[model samples]
Target chain A: MVRPRYFFSETFISLRRNFFMGFTAITTVAITLFVVGFFTIIVYDIQGIISSVESEVELAVYLEDEISEELKDYIEKEVLSWEETDSVNYVSKDQALERFREQNEGSDILKEIEGNPLPASFEITLSSPEKIDQVALRFYDKDGNYIEGVNDVIYGKNYVNKLFSITAIVGTIALLIIIVLLLAAIVLIFNTIRLSIYARRKEIEVMKLVGATNWFVRVPFLFEGFFEGFVGSVISIILLYFVGNFLLIRGERVIVDTMRIKELAIVGSSGVVLYVYIGVAVLGGLIGILSSAIALRRYVKI
Target chain B: MNMIEFKQVSKIYEDNTVALKNINLEIKKGEFLFLVGPSGSGKSTFIKLLIKEIEETEGSIFIAGRNICNLKSNRIPQLRRNIGCVFQDFKLLPNKTIFENVAFTLEVIGKPVYEIKIQVPQVLKLVGIFSKINSYPHQLSGGEQQRVSIARAFVNRPPILLADEPTGNLDPGTSEGIMKILSRINLIGTTVLMATHDRNIVNSMRRRVVELEEGEIIRDQKRGVYGD
Candidate 1:
């Protein structure tokens, strides 16, 4: 029933008195949340990269040279209608030749040819990379009676399977590590807040002896815990901002050029980054409140 | 009218140690009473029971006509606020100044700032330590600290003041000053109950004495000496 200002001042005084303990708590919370934020960005980027790689696992069906453009259109329509198909694109012989030339930039072997030798092909991409073999077999049936205008199906059999397995393993490991790290962060923060409360046992005893109600004794510690969490979260968010900007400055070129992917941009858009910061701050505040509640329970008797 | 009453109160600990036997006693309003007993003779237990610090194993206790035995656990703070208590060790917050320590009781009970500002200095003056209001408990001597503690307890003007050996840690001269202050407080119609083993103070004051032995009262006398 004490005045609201008294509770706040008490909390502030306790936090000041135990400055070293409070600082240690804040530092521990910040480091834990920093690691968590780092892994969060990395995991998100890795998933982006994985999905991009998965989309790249497509089947190219080369057509017979004599097949009419109408037949190629029919094949494209049929592939597009399949349940497993994500998209179907028909590449003409000229377009295929252009792509080949661009891929092998300095090669003059194409100039020696009399006419365009590359066959027009249908590029079939599936909704899931794992369904590539099954959908590929639909075109070349068990009887080996291949579709009329189709010449051959070219798909990476071993490479696609290996990529799929590796991505699954990596995702599982990343998720497991994040869970473990978060648990450790909570325990460390809880213990630090508890130690701070323990240091003021005598003060707490005096407060109770003077007829302080349970909430009067406990709310101050709760506020202290909450402040620690919020401050720690702010520190971590600031560190993350700098690290994000640094990555954008130093590693942007390598990330873009080597990976041949734009998904590796640090922190994504400004709005999304802001949300991450807010999320971490809220999480830290919650940790502070919860840990304070738990820590003060032993010493705060009614 | 009786300000404090005990009805067959018995407190037995978890290990079957009898702290207070089935006993009954009463103190009228505005009377100063002394509880005298040896260390293991339930004097502390009696004070603790009155404050609801420990629940009685059997029987009822009434403070100012309210049966505190049936009071809810959460309401104990409300009960405690109506009764001021002083301790043997002078439990003052070491870091807080004497003024802060005195004003803390009012603050905890949610008194206004203006009221605290008015009452704290007045009570500190009455306890004869107004000049040292800004001094911390560690900076003050034992007598000064006990006075600060007394100032805190009486600042709220609770109807009953329980001093559990208030002068236990002070010298004889200092003890006399504390007793005088307590007696003055009692004269102003605040009921005072002091538990002590000091024979000289008991003989000099010759107040209403309730002597206990083996968790039972053996004597209750008006203006009684230490051995009477």
Candidate 2:
């Protein structure tokens, strides 16, 4: 207890003499942590959006001209009975011609057409957008062969591809920023510990002269780093919560008008935010402590 | 048998500068030993070798029946805890008060809180620095700072205390005071090893002396006096 008291006292004294360095270090920690927190938010939210969008696409199938009305009705019933299909709409050839004629009434090509050559089609909505490709592949397969009654099936493949690409870019950029900031935090911590050790050179030398072991002298310094890291992490967390609330909750509501995210959850319901913050904090503290240990070893042999 | 035995110890720098060469010596318990030599005569290197600060290039050093020369790097800290040391700079912690400086040694070995509180003050009082317990290193005079430094060294009560030119930077009066304190500590049964070139303080003490010449022990005597 006396040893820990003495070590704590020493840490406090060093904090006084090197207040500027300590302040610089905490600020560096806060900024790095904040960047990591903010970018992590963007990364996760964009991923959620990508998943939502990916699950939304459905296929549109246009029928061939030779399919009779009876077979058409049968195919419709079969597609509807399947658990995968949500809803299907049929347009008779005559109805399709009427609809197309209504849409292109202002066009000269519609006026010039003597008879409607366009085929009727089925606009199919599936239970899941991910199944669009599966349904498209199965569209003409019947009795282990092509049905020959359906035309091309189209869905949004390129949009899902684009969303994934965007997500990848965000993750890459976030990771790069975290690496740079973490390195900066380490350098700052190294210099802070170095300066503190420099200030106590005489005292450290005396500890050496008095038969104190090297680690015995070093425990106090290691404690100092731990204190800084723990405290800095706390401050960073508080700041991140406020920023997240402002930007994601209230700020997003003003722009989108129906944002349903809850209070930006300090201990988020998803648990991911909390874990991410703690992981970054622990990482920051550990780095600070290890860097200080290495730097202090050089200057304080005792 | 001697408490410390050096057998043909030789230390050469990486650049091939020989610090100690073919050196052999024994230091006995309860003996207040003085090593007198000029600068660069391997006095510091000799002390460094005893604690294994720097390893001897050629031979061995035996302390307490153990040939410490072969001790691994990890064991050096424990070996040093048994041997207290002081240097010319007075080496008192500038940031800490006099009391904290004295308590530092005991704290290193994980001493109990109650024990530290009592021991620190008692040691400071013994060194006559109890009045200046709260004084920082810069606030006190060199003599008082050295006294605090002394208190810190003896607080752990290591059986052997090594002083390397402890009074090299002090005036004659302060140096005499330091010698008197060392003598008092020696009277209490702590074996002391002090290296100095102060002729006046040396002649007055009349203790055992070992003189070194170019990394060699040229003279040794009991009831030793100041000499060439």
Query: Which candidate tops lDDT?
Result: 1
User: Least accurate stretch of 10 residues (summed lDDT) in model 2 chain B?
Assistant: B91-100
RMSD of each: 3.2, 4.6
Model 2 DockQ class: medium
List-wise, what DockQ does each model earn?
Answer: 0.55, 0.51
**Lowest lDDT 10-residue stretch of candidate 2 chain A:** A259-268
User: Per-residue CA lDDT of candidate 2, range A105-183, in tens?
Assistant: 8899887777778878887877765566567777767665447687766677676556667878888988898889888
Q: Write the per-residue lDDT of candidate 2 for residues B1-228, one digit (tens) a residue.
A: 577888999999899988888988888777888888888888899888887778789998998778998897667767877887877887766656788777777876778888989999988888888999888889998888788878887887877788989998899999888888888888887878898888887788898988887888888988887686
Roughly what TM-score does model 2 have, to 2 decimal places?
0.84
**lDDT by residue for model 1 over B59-79, one digit each (tens)?**
999999999998997788888
Best by DockQ: 1
Worst 10 residues of 1 chain B by lDDT: B73-82
Off by over 4 Å in 1: A62-75, A92-120, A126-153, A161-168, A262-270
